[model samples]
Target: MISVLFAVLTAISNGSASVLQRRAASTVPDAEAMHLSLIRHLLRKKVWLAGIGLVVVAAVCQAVALATGPIAVVQPIFVIELPATLLIASCAFRVRLSRSAWRGVASVTCGLALGMAAAAPGGGSESVPGYRWIPALIVTGVFEAALIIWSRRLRGNARAALLGLAAACGYALTAALMKDAVSRLDNGGGVLALVSAWQLYGMAVAGVGALFLLQNALQAGSLVASQPMLTLGDALISITYGVTLFGESLRSGWWLLPELIGVALIAAGCVELARSPLMTGAKPPPPRVR
Candidate 1:
C-alpha cells in the first residue's frame, strides 16, 4: 500500500512537472541562440523560474518514491504521467490535443496499468550497498558527455527530442544506481557513508544534467512530442534495469498470457496516439495560472 501511494505521488509530480516545463518553454521565442544563453534567458524569466521550481519539487517527490518502492513499480506509474500531462496542458493552457494524441495517452495509460498489475507483489526491504554505484555513475557520465557533444550539431525539434531522450537515459541510470545504494544500506552509518562518498555527488551531477537537457528539449519542440517520448524512454530503461539487474520480478509464467495481450493493446494505442496530427504541428501554448 505504501508503494502504491508512492507511485501515485510520482505520477502527480511527473504530470505537473511536464506541464510546468512546457509552459516555460512556450515563453521563449523560436529563434536561433546558444543553448546556454537560451537556458539562462529562460531561467531568468519569472515564468520559467516558477516552472523550474515545480520540476524541482517533482524531482524531490521522485527521490522519495524511489526510496520507498521498487523502480519497476514506481517508474511505470511515473511514465503514465505523460498522458496526464497532455490533458493538464490542454485544459490549463488551452493547448489543443489532436485525436491521435488522445489515443496515444489512452494507449500508454492502458499499457502501464497492465504492466503495473503484472509486477511482482513484494515491497523492497533492502538498502542500497556502497561502492556498487561507481560503474553506473561512470557509464551515465560517459553517456551525458556524448549527448552534449552530439547535441551541438543538431537543430530544432529533432535536437530537442534527442536531448530529452538522453536526459531520460541519464535519469534512468541514476535511478538504478540510487536504488542499489539505498537497498544496501545497513544503518544510518551506511547511509551517511554513502552520502559522503564522491559517487553520491556524481549522481547529483547526473541528475542536474538530465534536467538541463530535458529543459532544452522542451524549448525546442512541442511538449506533446517531447514529454511522452522522454517519459516512455525513461520508463523502458528503468524497467529493463530493474528486472535484469536488480532482480525485480514480474508475474510468474502463468500470467504471461494476459501480460502479452496487455502489451499488444498498449502498443496499438501508442501507435494510434503517435499518428495523431495534433502532435506533429502543435505549438506550445502561452503560460497561464492554474
Candidate 2:
C-alpha cells in the first residue's frame, strides 16, 4: 500500500510538471523543435523550471515506490498521470470540466482498479541481473534512436506521439535502473553502495534524456497527442521491464480477460480525456455576472 500511495504521489507530481512544461514548450518557435536550441529556449522559461522542480519531487517519490514494492505494481499506477494532468490544467485555466471529462476520469479510475486486481502484479526481485541490463540498454537505445529518426520526418501530432513514446521508454528504463541501484541501500551496502552503483548513474542519464525528449514532445503538438502516448506507453513499457528485468509475475489465463478489458477502458478514457477542450487549449468560457 505504501508503494501505491507513493506511486500516486509520483503521478500527481509528474502530471503537474507536464502541464507546466507544456505551457513553456508551446511558446518555442517551430524551427527550434527537436534541436538543442529548443532546450535553450525552455531554460529561460520560469514555468519550465518549475516543472523541472516537480520532476525532482516525482523522482524522489518514484525511488521510494520502486524501493518499497514490485516495479509491476508501482509503474502501472502512473497511468493516472493523464487524468491528473486534465484536472490540474482545468484548475489552472479556470475552466470547469465537462460531463464527458468526468466520465473519462471515472473510466480511467475504474479500469486501473480492475486491471490491477485482475493482474495482481507481485513477486518481483529488488535487483535485476547485470547481464540483463546490457541487452536492455542496447535494445532501448536502438529503439529510441529509431523513434527519434521517425519522429523527425513527421510534424505536429504524429511527431509528438512518437517522441512521447520514446520518452516513455527512457522513463521506464530509468525506473528499472533506479530500482536496481536503490536496492543496494537495503542490501547491506547502504548509501555508499548506492552511490557506487553504475545503475545509479545510468538512471541519471536516462532520466535527463527522457526529460529532454518530453520537452520536445510538448513543443511539437498539443497534449491531446502527446499525453496519452506518454502515459500509456510508460505504463506498458514499464510493466515489460518489470517482468523481463526483475522477474515480476502477474496473473494469467482467465485473468487476462479482465486485464485486457481494463487496458481497453484505460485507453478509451485517455482518448476522451485528451480531447477535452481544456486540454486542447480552447479559450475558456468568460465569467458572467450572476
Q: Top model by TM-score, which number?
A: 2
Q: Compared with the true structure, what per-residue lDDT tens digits does model 1 show for residues 5-95?
A: 7666667666666556666665676573335667876766776676667666766677667767788777767765556555665686566
Show the lowest summed lDDT stretch of 10 residues, model 1: 273-282
Tell me the TM-score of each prediction against the true structure.
Answer: 0.75, 0.94
Candidate 1: residue 212 lDDT (0-100): 74
Q: Point out where model 1 deviates above 4 Å.
A: 26-34, 87-102, 118-125, 128-131, 146-148, 180-186, 190-194, 197-199, 251-290
TM-score of candidate 1 versus the correct structure, residues matched by position: 0.75
In order of listing, the candidates' clash counts read 12, 0
- Cα lDDT of candidate 1 equals 0.65
Worst 10 residues of 2 by lDDT: 279-288
lDDT of 2 at 243: 90
